[model samples]
Target: MNLDQYLPVLLFIIVGMAVGIGPLVLGYVLGPNRPDDAKNSPYECGFEAFDDARGKFDVRYYLVAILFILFDLEIAFLLPWAVALQDVGLAGFIAVLIFLAVLVVGFVYEWKKGALDWE
Candidate 1:
């Protein structure tokens, strides 16, 4: 295999890394070293923390967040499938329909399990 084919990819990766790391290097070098009590203290919207930062939270919060992300990502697949609907033809359409049906079933299951209920 010709190594020349990979030169552009190598250069692309090097440039990408430099672009990402350059600003961070410059900021550390040029930024002032300043640390005050106000800056170091734990703050919450201009007020001091009233409770422990490691306080336990309700499991429902996490469950709801995960469900939202799961459904959100599943929905995102629709966009690409929609854009290429013409090229994908009947088989692709049926596949997306099956995917949607499964998504609906999962949603109904979650709903029946009281996961969607908020007290």
Candidate 2:
């Protein structure tokens, strides 16, 4: 088979690699060499790193993070549904309504259990 068919793909790969690596190489070559104590120090924050990196955190951190991801991804479904609203008609509308109902129920459950309370 002729390799001409793959010319665009080869060019795309080369360009993609250049775009990804060019900035990194340029930064290493041209960036400042300043490395003072504050810059080089293990600064987790202005405050010292109190907790061990591997220390067991309270489950609330994971719970909050998972909840954020869940709601964030739930919104992602809206774009496709909005685009295909006419094609999907009533069935799609009802399906989304049911999905929303379940989400609300879960939210209520979490609220009742005080999982959403900060303090």
Candidate 3:
């Protein structure tokens, strides 16, 4: 392989790295070196931390968050599929319907099990 062909690609990579790291390096070298008691404190809100920083949270919060992401991504798949509906034809349409049906079933199951209910 001719190495000359890769010169532009190598330059692109080097420039990309410089662009990514240049500002960070500049900021660290040029930034102020000021660390007062308020800055060094564990909590910076001028109030002492009443509880441990690593506190245990209710699992439901994570469960709901995960469920939200799962459903959100699944719904996102519909956007491109909708845009290309004519090209994908009936088969794609039916496939999306089935996908939506499964989503509905999962949502209904979660709802019936009170997974969506917050007290």
Candidate 4:
């Protein structure tokens, strides 16, 4: 291994650090220092913190969050599938269909169990 091969990697690390830290330093120096009650208060899931931070949360809150993540990840698969559609051909299409079918079944199960109900 030659040092020449590592030069780009070193430059990339330096650039990444600059990109990450530059805006943060600039914001601290240039942004307004306006803090109020709302800004200082602890917020949880868009609601004001009412109970002990470590206390149990409603199971539905976690269920809804998990459902959102599940669908979000499913949609993420579409990007790669779309890119490789021609390469994968019909088998990929069928595999995605099967994946969607399983998701729909889980969705129906959750719906029947009232996991989606707000109350």
Candidate 5:
């Protein structure tokens, strides 16, 4: 097996590691060591932490976050499909319609369940 083909992969790994760790290394070496009460304190939403670190959070918080990611990714998929509309033709169009139908059904289900309600 020719080892030359692996040279680029090795270099890529080295560069990737350097890029990932370089900032931390430089910051630790060059940055000042400073810690104060305000800087080290737990902060939340422009205020100090009011609850315990492991306090229970409302289930709706997680539900909303998951729904946001679900809808966000589904929307992101539309960009590629739109770009390839000419190549995919009618079949792709119908597939996307079905996908959209499913998405709408899920949204409606969540809405009916009051998952979207903040209060």
Candidate 6:
């Protein structure tokens, strides 16, 4: 094979690498060199770190996070389904209905179990 055919590919690879690394190299060369206690200290949520870094968090925190992710993913699926509604026909509509019903049931179960309670 002629290597000339690969010239564009090689140029693309080199340019991609330069675009990715150029800013980093320039920052390191031109950025500030000062470090202070406040700048170097570990900061979190507007407060100083008071607990162990590996401390166990409350299960409610995880529960809420999981619920958020579940609904977020449901929205992701919904956007695509809506965009393709004309192409999916009745069968796809029914399938999404069932999916939504199941999600509603789970939501109700979680509500009754007080999993959504903050206190």
In terms of TM-score, which candidate is strongest? 5
For each candidate, the alpha-carbon lDDT, in order, equals 0.89, 0.86, 0.87, 0.89, 0.90, 0.89
- The residue pairs that clash in candidate 6, if any, are none
Per-residue lDDT of candidate 6, residues 19-91 (tens digit): 9999999999999989777775666443454446786667876898899999999999999999999999999
Model 6 per-residue lDDT at 94: 100
Model 2 misplacement above 4 A: 1-48
RMSD of 1: 6.0
Residue 21, model 3: lDDT of 100
Tens digits of per-residue lDDT, candidate 2, 36-71, equal 776656563333444467766678878999999989
lDDT of 3 by residue, 1-119 (tens): 88999999999999999999999999999999897776666563434544576866667778889999989999699999989999999999999999999999999999999899877
Report the number of backbone clashes for model 4: 0
Report the error of model 5 at residue 76, Å.
Answer: 2.2
TM-score of 2: 0.62
Q: TM-score per candidate, in order?
A: 0.59, 0.62, 0.60, 0.61, 0.66, 0.63
Per-residue accuracy of model 5 over 1-119 as CA lDDT, tens digit each: 99999999999999999999999999999999887787767564333555477866778778988999999999799999999999999999999999999999999999999999987
Could you tell me how far off, in angstroms, the CA of residue 30 lies in candidate 4 after the best superposition? 12
Which model, 2 or 4, shows the larger lDDT? 4
The TM-score ranking, best first, is 5, 6, 2, 4, 3, 1
Q: How far in Å is the alpha carbon of 5 misplaced in model 3?
A: 14
lDDT of 1 by residue, 37-106 (tens): 7676766344454457787667887898899899899869999999999999999999999999999999
